[model samples]
Target: MDSPNVLLLLTTLSLTVSSAISGSVVEDLANLQPPSDFNTTIMKNCQHNPSLRYCNSSSVDLKEIFRFTIVASHLCNESKNPNCVHSFDKIDLRNRPKIAPLYLSYSFFWKYCPSTIFSIDLSNTSLKGSFPTEVLCCAQIQALDLSLNGLAGEFPIESFSPLTNLTSLNLSYNYFSESKISDSRFFKRFNASSFIHSGLISYQECFKESTSLTPSMLRAATNGFSRKNQIVRSEGVEIYKGTLRDGTEVRIEVYRDCISREKRQEFVEECKVLVELRHKNLVQVLGWCSNRNKRAIVTEWTDGETIEMWLSDSAPPWKLRLKILSGVVAGMLYLQENWPEVVSDIRIDSVLLTDNHEPLLSRFQVGDRYRNSKKIHWFGIFLLEIITNRRSQEFERGEAGFIEHVRENYPENLHEVIDARMKLPENIFDQAKHGIELGLMCTDQSISKHPGLDQISHMINKVYESCLELAPQNHKRSHGDGEEQQDDQSKQQKTTPERSETGDTVYNITCSSQWIESAPVVLKMTSSRY
Candidate 1:
């Protein structure tokens, strides 16, 4: 039947409830379903179980409609009878076994209703005021249509978190124009039609497209982009910390030398590319502004140290270091696989380290020279830098570089060749050697002789997995002198591994990854002999 007929059927059902129930309930149900023509509207195809009266109605108080129906129809006490079908006006059960389940959808439907609600159609209803938070109560509601109604205020994007089963949502022709949603990840599936005529919802906001920010907004966010707000001055780019009008923290990158027309065009083109790229391991470019001879890109702010600063600050464990390396590699792989171009400049300076020691690759485009250079060979050089703890450029003037250095020193003192920042676990010497060997394989001059990126990733995973397994069982005490040293030796002699500064075992870090991957709760890495 048409939607108008559906509304008419619901009105008739409400009238029936009013006629059967007490005078007070009749008034309440009357409030739910406003006065409508009773002559033309009738419950045409309703099939209610005699013992347990169940019914469905729209254009009524969604919260109080079911309560009124239950009290008026003698289904109040039959809550335990799961097989009992409910009474509804014009609902054909033969064709729609789906609608039979959602007869008692309300605040606590799970505890009261027999079956799950798969869909809810409240279109052209009296649903008004704030967007209903109660909709989340329907955990199994997959398809929702709240169109052609009164829904105001900024829609709570977070309110939909519990409805993991929701597949389709429609809120078109509603009053959500002034509503501002900061994060767009929640509404990825909904198209422009769902939010059409709602001025607040736009393509730039929903898809997280790079908005054209006004010069004034940028200035207000950054305190006029003053030196006080400057976070970093790297590669002729001055980065300043700022917050949007909605209180979103952002990092504003002002190009100090994009004065040339060619440079400005490059910046604009790069912004186009950056807007398309979205990954956890890369900085998110929010928007850009090119006004009054100033060129700047606004991105999501992360209070992270550069890889250069991180390595300089303190020696991190091999497991943590390898995770950072893996993230960098993954980011590069994503760029290579998805985008037309890769992150040409992969170095310590290009990688940012989170507080928890995760890495994010920045500076995506390589500009003029790198765009023309042999790109695939650069990743091998990046790998060599991590293994040798030396910058790739430094290897150019040095004696034989990392590849040759490893070739001469392997099978004997692999420990000495590895970065002194990490003390290799004695139990996994071959694993560590294999990692170094893979790095060497990447740096091979012959392109055919070099290991593929996938092969390199697999080998790194093996080494990373080994480090995770052995790190928990093995503990090393800080080497010192006198009584403190002896005390450390006694602690190291114990079977349990040394706890970190956080007082948690190194195994805690390793276990988090294992659980994240849905792997076995415990992993056992035994000797080759075993």
Candidate 2:
């Protein structure tokens, strides 16, 4: 299971699949494995159920560096030729999904190209031929690893300027004279260490020259750092998905060894801390794996909408907006009142809403090492996002973010940020405005003055509670203006007018006393008397 090492995993999974299908009604696949192709090596673990086929797989191999080498041999059929150029616009490698070349192996896969892949890995390949100079075309190249290769000659500066987007450049372990590139005008702007491990100011390059043209061979040859999977799962946890002796579907997110030891340990500590909280508003962290070899987090994946998607997509109506914000406040309050030590990093993407609109907060604090003003900024930003439906990053008018809306016309008509689908009840219009004012206050540029998570919760509670007390129904439109909202109240008034067990009338406000033939005033009931 380590790095999935496809050559080995294919054999193992095939046998497992064959055995699994025979034991239970569920069918497994060992015979369905496909022959390896230049694009991918698919070893199936398929379970076909008339309508569909399900399969799970781990990626095998990744280009430590993706680049090109100069070919001394004519086998170097230079298709782009004499040019020795390969376009990133041509490497269609990611489409295969299941296949990725590791280290120098990626240097072997330059046939299909991509137009915009900057970060490439071509380490650990003894690719001969001079370096393919044309890959400099990838203007967006940032991190490139071409370490541990057989490359020589003066490093060219013209080949690098096109890749101005680059930040981390690695060209260690090569044949070039260290002093040459160190003093060369082209390599001077970058750090001396970027050309490490050689007599020449060395840089990594592609394994193959143009004997056969490929997409990314050149890019990998330049930047000499490995581009392996950096996102890791937690440690000590096994990814279980079969039967558990019982009939239930086993589910788990196992940790992978991609994260640093420290972060993994922090993740584990956070999991341990979160396990102590029993609140329903906070997501339950069932368990976590924190062993040094591997690390990962295991929390239930709620099958509903995320707050960002909910707002940006299928936008719910105005009433629903209040309801959602209310749920968000209730959850935050529960966390602060009970688990303030751990809950932090409250941002729009971090908060989720269930199908019923109950909000659940995630990515809370587990370890003390990684919490601070960022947390306040995050929580305040979350509230600001809910109020403005604009990301906090856009707060300044520079990017036109949520707060920018208020900045353009605040204390004047702050309703612009409110969801167009929602309505402001007559009485709580002020409260809604007040809440927005608080959001504007909370999302201030001066981090020092921004409200804390608890204070944000308080502001929302105060604004909403006061608003509800005054308007109860949440809006103030009459039959002509608020007829749509009053429909719900009208039903409630007629059905259980007073919440009576038998559904009795709650009020006897005589129309005769209020209505005159010439001027019948609509009874503006201040609050729900029923």
Best by lDDT: 1
Runs off by more than 4 Å, candidate 1: 1-204, 233-236, 258-263, 366-376, 392-400, 447-449, 470-530
lDDT string, candidate 2, 151-239, tens digits: 77666655676666677666766676444444555455544344446445322322111022111321222121123312223444344
Candidate 1: residue pairs that collide? 54-86, 54-87, 55-87
True-structure RMSD for candidate 1: 19.1
Model 1 per-residue lDDT at 319: 68
Local distance difference test values of all predictions, in order: 0.53, 0.43
Q: Provide TM-scores for the models.
A: 0.51, 0.39
Candidate 1 clashes: the total is: 3
lDDT of 1 by residue, 1-530 (tens): 43322232233455455456653222343345433543223233232221111234333233343443333232211222222233221111111222222332334332223223355655545455777665555555676766656678767777787777777676765787455453566666554435544455765554444577887998899898788888888887788999887566888988655377776776777777776665546776778887547788887788898877776677665666677767776676667677746463667777788764668876767333443124435665566566557664556755247566666765355555666566544444334444554454445443333444554465465556546435443535422111122234323322222344544322211222221233223322111221
Worst 10 residues of 1 by lDDT: 88-97
